[model samples]
Target chain A: DQQVKQNSPSLSVQEGRISILNCDYTNSMFDYFLWYKKYPAEGPTFLISISSIKDKNEDGRFTVFLNKSAKHLSLHIVPSQPGDSAVYFCAANPGNTPLVFGKGTRLSVIA
Target chain B: NAGVTQTPKFRILKIGQSMTLQCAQDMNHNYMYWYRQDPGMGLKLIYYSVGAGITDKGEVPNGYNVSRSTTEDFPLRLELAAPSQTSVYFCASSYRRETGNEQFFGPGTRLTVL
Candidate 1:
């Protein structure tokens, strides 16, 4: 069974619009969550992360929201640009354990 | 610094063949991990090492073995390759675990088994 799940396989957004990607987890032991963006033929790069203690964290145009009670998280990108197109993976880690990843969601930003 | 490096960007293996995928990191990290990503899927851990001489299996460790004789190197061995083993493999290193520390990943190695 998958502990973390990205139900949406793909998401498309127009330039200058907001994009949201959602993820859910079945395990309550996860304390930290992260997002990674991967371009074709390259390794996934770190995007942003949020701790279970906080409800939201923002960096520039990227924002991550965490809801511990719901066991859910979402990544938001404001004014999405074409350069933001890539595969995004949601990952979570329990204390003192390795990360568990969900199936990635492919984001397409049309300019 | 070359944070992490993997050899043989792409390879093709025949059934029953054996090979070792080499991974090295220059960041002097205490943690190293190996993962495999199938097409359109997220990465699944194969093996990991906390430090030199300390290695452990991950979610998917069947048909694979690993060794960490030194801090800078971790090698994954595939014994008796099978068709189901085809996938892209990645190597990553982090300063620590469960600290929200981002992992630095190397260019992946794509392998196909016939």
Candidate 2:
């Protein structure tokens, strides 16, 4: 069963616009959530993460908001750039257990 | 420093063949993990190691073996290749920090079985 899910397979946005990606989880025990971006033929790179204790975290242009009650999380990129185009995967770790990942959302930024 | 390194970027194996995928990390992270990714699917954990000589199976560990002889190396072995095993494999490592721990991944190894 897929504990973590990213329902949107693809998202497109204009450059310099805000891009929002959403994720949902079924396992309530997950305490840590992370987002990774991957390019073609390359391994995924870490982007941003949020702890269960905090509802929001921001790093540079990327921000992650978590809603514990709804079991949903989202990543927002301000003034999205063309370089931001890639597949983003949402992952969660439940109390020291191995991380579970979502299928991923492909983001395309049109210049 | 090369954070995580995986050799044999691409490989093709016949059914019943066996091979070892090499993974090495220069970051000196104590936690290492192996995951496989299929098309339109997220990564699935195959195995993991907390430290030297400490190994455990993850979500999808069947037909696989692993050993941690040193902190820098963690290799995954496929006893017998199957068509279902064809996928892109990634090796990752993370520090022991309680918070803000981010996993660094290698370029990944793509394996195909016929």
Candidate 3:
């Protein structure tokens, strides 16, 4: 079973606009959530993370929001740039166990 | 530092063949992990090690074996190659500390089995 799910397979946004990617998880035990950005033929690089204790975390142009009641989380990038185009993966970690990842969403920022 | 490094970036294997994927890290991390990524599916953990001479199976460990002989080296072994095993494999390492620790991944190795 897929504990983490990214419903959208792909997303497109214009430069300088806000790009939002959504993810949901079925497991309630997950306390830490992370987002990773991956380019072609490269490994996934950590971007932003949010702990269950907080509802939101921000880093520069990226912001992650978590809703524990809904078991959903979203990543928002404001003023999206062309360089932001890549596959974004959402992962969840329950306690000390390994991360469970979503299928990934391909984000395309148009110039 | 070179961080994490994986050998044989690409490989092709036939059924019943056996080979080992080598991984090494220069950051002197005590925790190491192996994961595989298929087409649209995300990465799945295969095995992990806490320290030298210690190993444990992860999400998907069947048909695979792993060993950690030193703080820098963790090798993954494929006993019998199968078509279902064709995928991209990644090796990662992290410090023993739990807080503020993030895994560093290798470039990955693409394996094709026929």
- The top-ranked prediction according to TM-score is 1
Query: Can you tell me the DockQ of model 2?
Result: 0.72
For each candidate, what is the lDDT?
0.93, 0.94, 0.91
Instruction: Give lDDT tens digits, candidate 2, residues A52-106.
Output: 8899999999999999999999999998999999999999877676678899999
Interface RMSD of candidate number 3: 1.9
TM-scores, one per candidate: 0.97, 0.96, 0.94
Q: Candidate 2 or 3, higher DockQ?
A: 2
User: Which candidate has the top score in DockQ?
Assistant: 1
lDDT of 2 at A84: 99
Backbone clashes, each candidate: 0, 0, 0
Report lDDT (Cα) of residue A60, candidate 3.
98
Clashing pairs in 3: none
Candidate 1 lDDT by residue in tens digits, B1-114 = 988999989999999999999999999998899999999889999999989999999999999999999999999999999999999999999886444867888999999999
Give candidate 2 misplaced runs (Cα > 4 Å): none
In Å, residue A16's CA in model 2 sits off its true spot by 1.6
Per-residue CA lDDT of model 3 for A36-91, tens digit only, reads 89887887888988888889999999999999999999999998999999999998
Inter-residue clash pairs, candidate 2? none
